[model samples]
Target chain A: MKGIRSVLYMHWRSVGSWVYIPWLILGSVFLINYGWRSFHQDSQSTNDVGNMVIFIYLFTVAWIFNGQLFAFASGLSIKRMHFVLGSVMAAILISIGSSLLLMLLIVVENMTNGWGIDWHTFSWKVTQTFAYWEQFAIYLLVFLCLILLGFFLSSIVIRFRKRGLLVFGVLLYVFFLVISNTSVNGFDHEEAFWTWIGQHGLLVFYSLIPAIILLLFGCYMLFMRRAIIRS
Target chain B: MHVKLSKVRKAYGKNVVLNDINMVLEKEKIYGLVGRNGAGKTTLLKIIAAQLFPSEGTVQVNEENPFENEAILSQLCFVKESQTYPDHFTVKDILLTAKATFPLWDETFCQALVARYNVPVKLRMRKLSRGMRSVVGVIIGLASRAPLTIFDEPYLGMDAVARQYFYDQLLADYADHPRTIILSTHLIDEVSELLEHVIVVKEGRILMQEDVETLRAGAVTVTGEKGKVAAFIQQQHVLSSQTLGNVTNVMIFGTISRQERLQAEAEGLSFSAVSLQKVMVHLTDQEKGSA
Candidate 1:
């Protein structure tokens, strides 16, 4: 427990400020959108893409932290399990904090009618039907999934270096290509997928719990087996 | 803590880093792991610290496998020559994290060392100079006071005075709080006096491991007439031999009794104690020659 705590504290001190970067970016983008909409006045469309910035930032943070802090912690004689536990705990804490803040912003956006510009940054029309707790759960789960995915990818790179990344990239390209071909051949599943997610709501995110666990497990195996700090 | 490596081997594909290395490191002694570049010094240290796994064989720290064992890892602190920190981390952040990680961390000692080194606590690590970064590593190794502390060329960019200060502080701290210390460095002569035992590595094998006093006492360079030097070196393990005109100098790897020395002196032969550095060089050079 103490070892895990140490790693958590190290993570906090090392890149804690990075958590706010997405907020700063989102704030800037919101200001721009609000100013544009205020001038237009006739534009009633809501901007739902603004919240994606935090997800992207969290993914990047996880990847960089896994690459950099893992080596540093290993140098400090930290156990691999301790590092995994500590990092996962830190990710959870960050998810909780960010989710609560986003929930607050959603409430404020609703009350002020998107700050008088009719813009929807934190509140999406699809999720507005769900309860506050369910919406928070959705955000938290999405954050964890992205963060864990980042950790898994970085672990692959750490274990197998550039070759692993190249292989993964090729596989991802193939996957997307197959999906695109399927859609072009009239086997369109995008609408069905979204409908399913919309029907399931929180359950859709809850199903990702297994994947989160698998990603964490993969990271542990890669790190424990052969993760050396390359010079 | 006692560290034992038996038949330890590390290889990356066909390139073997450490081969068949077997050693027992006892408690409260400083062992110098001296070797040339790519001689497997760092590989052996990493295996011992559990940062790396041996390709074959086993390593036991305090009679337990250290891999993923937090209890054992907590007792070990390995400060690498190329030790890295997060770019945004301040020196104070590093120290605080070290304190939290090591169970026997000494805050007062750490603070004093920081003051002595004059490292800026608030400055991010990437902003610090190379020498200052090395100083931070030195301070962490000294103040952590782990039961098994290993420093692999921990003073890469440090100045002469700072390096000397590190040696003094290490010795002083070791005297008060005894523990096992393994120092792997290229600067053998500078740290020879500080080392209690020396492990000479060559070509992925242990060339020799001996007590410093034993090596100093047993290895000697005898200078005398060519005929007498030849006779003296006969049936002895001669590490190296050189001849200039009628005088011959031969370094042998065996002790000379006082009677033998007196007899040799009366016969007009002079003996000089071989420095640890010289012994290391000769030993490695002999291995190269044999290879």
Candidate 2:
């Protein structure tokens, strides 16, 4: 029971304390944007804020990834697997909670503005068509997926502390940004992989599911790793 | 609080650190684990603490395997020279965490030790000097009050005065709590007075395990002319020998009777009791030369 208590306490110290830093940063950015938009009477400015917030969210992921991961590594003693599981699970829960709360705020803002959410748009349809609990559940799932991605990256960093992961972090950011911003081809060909990924019925689910499963598996492997054996 | 290590072996790639070492540690006594640097003292302690798993054989504590076994480890406290903690935690925070983690942790004892050592509780662990950090470690080890407490070179950065204080406090506390305590230190003479049992380790093998009093009782030193000393040592197990001009002093294990003492004295010989420190050094040196 004391061991469990120690694990939970360590998790709270690492993930709980760090959860506030990114939440505050993202919360403040949203507050400032809401104040600016209200002052300027410009409805279009809100979309720009939403887009900018994505990069901020990514940075928050990097921050949470770094701090939570090092704490996880520090907590590793005799039972490396148990420590790693506690850490990765704590990180996942915190990241999901943070993302869900922020998404709820965004949806509230949209509803208060009397805007009609369009079903044809992927983001707007999910926000509008689903019932309150269903919408919340969907957002929670998406949040869990992203948090898993963050945890996966953190585990990779631990595995490669000898190699500079800072470079890898920057490259990952750029890769995600490019994938989100453009089609897979330069000439805008209809045969582009990104076009197919965006339109296909099964490809989207397939790609997303594997990423989630791989991340969870990576977290599992982190627990089983024996760094002391190497030492 | 007994540890039974059976055929324990640890290796790294091509090099072996501990080799088929079998040892038994009983309850309610102080044991001094003596060995040269890299002679597997720390490795042996770690194995007993369950911080490491042996490559072969078994280390059993309380009739169960130690690795991943919280029941045994919860009762054990191990203090190392380079113990690590997070950079964010101050010395007070680490102690607080330890208090929460260890069921038998004595916070009052820790606080008293903090005051006695004059440690700055508010200071970050990383900012503290090496000596001060060692003091913090000592405080933790003493205050943990675990059933099995193992301290490995605990006073490395401490001065003679502080080291003496540590030994005194350790003996004083141990007198009241009679738990199993194993101290691995290079300062043999300073701790020999407190040790109940001595386990001499050499080249990953246990050279000897005997009560300290018995070890001391069995050693005798004889000084005489070189010829007489040589003749006397040839008939006994000579541990060490020293020569000066025509005089030779030989340290040998086993008792020397009054008749033998009188005979040697008549042949220009001097006899005296050998201390534990002298015996340990001689034994270790003898081992090294043979190796």
Candidate 3:
């Protein structure tokens, strides 16, 4: 248990200062609001640019993980298994923790009446369309998936180093190529696939969470076992 | 703690780094891991540190496999020359983290070293000079108080003063807290006196492993007439030889008897004790060419 706690603490510290992530999320909100408030003639117009800012934050956090993984494994006095378990725990913390913080900011925004300028960064229509608890559940799901996506990408990037990035790019390009070619050449098959996806969209998206998590975890385990510090 | 490696083989894509190596390290002794560059010194250390997985056999620290073994790993600290810390972390941050994680951490000693080394606590690690960064590693290693600590060429960047300070501090601290310390270095002569044992590796194979004094006493270089030196060196393992005019200097390995020495002296041969560094180089040098 001490080893696990130590590994978890190391992972959190590797994420850098405690304030970095929160500041990244909140600072972006305030800066964008400052800019938006300055430019807007009509203050009533609502913008949900927080989603875009938060997505960038997710990407940056994932890159930090990739940068720190090698040293993170050997730095603290912990086994790779402990690190793996602790990382999964940290991932959940980041996901749920960031989600809750964003939700709280939205509550604060409501209290302050959107910083006195009706900036709807956190209180956007997509989230507000749902009931209170439903809204909480929705962000929880979204943030979890977003963080998982970040972790998956980071795991691949760190596990294989530069080769992983090249492969990722190639795979994405091939995927796009396949989609464009099939859609243009055979619209009927594409249309049928879309109809099926529409019928089971929620189920497909939800199932992908575990599939992505499992795939990343598998790759992480296989590579990190033999991983050497790339000094 | 005891560490044993049995038939360990590490290779990468047909390039063998370590080959069929077997070794056992006993508790509470300082060891010098001596080898030339590209001699697989770091690789062997990494294996013992469990930062690397062996390709063939088993490595056990304290009678248990160290690979992902928390019980064993918690008792070890492996410091490297090129360790990287997170960008925003100060030296204080690193020390604090180390203190928190390592159960046997000595905060007072750590802070004392910090002051002695003059490393600023508030400055970010990235901003520190390479030498300063190395001092930080030295501080962490000394203050961690792990039973088995390995420092692999981490003093490469330190100046003479800092290096001497580290050696002195290391010796003083080791005297206070008796634990196993392995200094893997090419600078053999500098640490020869401090080491209880020496392990010499050449091209991924153990050339020799023995106590420092025994290893040094195992060889003697005799200088005299070429014929007398040749006669005396006969039936003895000749490590190296050089012929300067009539004088023939021959480094003979293994011990020589009192009668043999008297006979050699009577035959006009004078003996000189070989430095451990010279012995290491002579023993490992493939072109130990006889002149």
> DockQ for each of the predicted structures, in order?
0.80, 0.21, 0.52
lDDT score, residue A183, model 1?
70
How well is each residue in B116-211 modelled by candidate 2, as lDDT tens digits? 889999888889988888898788788878888889888878889888988998899888877899999888889989999999887787888999
Model 1's CAPRI class is: medium
- In candidate 2, position B280 carries an lDDT of 78
Q: What TM-score, over all chains together, does every model reach?
A: 0.94, 0.78, 0.89
lDDT of 2 at A54: 44
Task: Give every collision pair in model 3.
Answer: none
Q: State which candidate, 1 or 2, has the greater TM-score.
A: 1
Predicted model with the maximum DockQ: 1
Which candidate do you rate higher for lDDT, 1 or 2?
A: 1
Runs of candidate 1 exceeding 4 Å displacement: A174-202, A208-226, B286-291
lDDT against the true structure, each candidate: 0.86, 0.69, 0.77
True contacts kept of 3: 0.45
Point to the candidate with the largest TM-score. 1
Model 3 lDDT per residue over B1-291, tens place: 899999999998899999988998999999999887888888888889888778999999999988878888888988888677877677877887778767899999998999898899989888999999999999989999999989988797789899888888888889999899999888888887689999988889887889998888888999999988888888888888899998899888887889988987987899999888898888788677121
Clashing pairs in 1: none
Ranking by TM-score: 1, 3, 2
Q: How accurate is candidate 1 locally (lDDT)?
A: 0.86
